[model samples]
Target: MNSRLPENELDELPREIIDFAKHIAALPDEFQDDMETAYNRVVDSVRRRRRILGLVQEALAQLRLDIKYLMFDLEMTRRERDELREQLGD
Candidate 1:
């Protein structure tokens, strides 16, 4: 799909962070510690984001399942109603 979401989906960290990580190792020695700190922050943020996203995905999946089951039951009820009416010649 032509979407921005499926690209990194370990819960959607900003592209800039990934870019920074890719280049952090190339920074001068004096800046490496700061870069390391920033990279660690990005990792933590990504982890939290993934947890939240996982919960949301699970909830949505459950809602879809429930909707499907309810629809199936409603259809069955309608069929039963129709059969009973036919038997009663109504």
Candidate 2:
């Protein structure tokens, strides 16, 4: 018989406090539609921002790779042109 009941001590709370608690308890039901709408808006905003960041990151990486390739190609082209010019004695 060492069990304990889950009764709360808030039973002795003042009327104002109890009323406040009741109001808080009813908040979910009272603001149901507004809460749902706000949650969806927040979730959708996060998804959109994440997608935008992903796209930006991908674009930047590709641009960096492109710049690297372009620089390598430019250096190779210049070397080849110089060799040809020297070989042709021009």
Candidate 3:
């Protein structure tokens, strides 16, 4: 198994987690199984959470843009209605 973690992962994950993985990697082959599995699980979980967070942030940004567009559309429609009413009154 590849024990070397990617540099980006090293930067994103907590130092303690990285240290623990390194410790597990350093173990003798016979002693590495259970702890290695646990470490892999933790790393996977963290990465999954980060991905989910990024998606949510992107969604929020899109929602904000949609809301601004809707607001502008509403204002333009109101102004047009008012202009038509003034022309009819004249």
Candidate 4:
């Protein structure tokens, strides 16, 4: 497989990823600080999303277990109802 990116897509990449030290050194101090702050915010957002995703997965697992129990209960109730009907007929 060709590892090289198409030229058009390459142009859309951030300069820092292409050449980190050179790109950061070329920028003014304030701009660099802003970039760092933005990067930190993105990292924090990803962490929060991962934590929420884990909680959602746990809830879904619990929901599946609850559904299984409810299905079993429904089947048991149906059997009891049928037995009661037979007894009443006899």
Output the number of the lDDT-best candidate: 3
- Give lDDT: candidate 1, residue 54: 98
For 1-90, candidate 2 gives per-residue lDDT tens digits of 001212353443335544544444456676755655564455456557767989999999999999999999999999999999999996
The model with the greatest TM-score is: 3
The per-candidate count of clashes, in order, stands at: 0, 0, 0, 0
Ranking by TM-score: 3, 4, 2, 1
lDDT of 4 by residue, 30-87 (tens): 7877765665465456557767989999999999999999999999999999999999
lDDT of 3 by residue, 24-81 (tens): 8788998889888888899899989999999999999999999999999999999999
- Give per-residue CA lDDT, model 1, range 47-70, as digits (tens): 798799999999999999999999
Q: Which residue segments of model 3 deviate by more than 4 Å? A: 1-3, 26-30
List candidate 2 segments past 4 Å from native: 1-26
lDDT values, one for every candidate: 0.75, 0.62, 0.87, 0.66
Give the RMSD in angstroms, all C-alphas superposed, for model 3: 2.2
Candidate 2 or 1, higher TM-score: 2
What TM-score does candidate 3 get on C-alpha atoms?
0.82
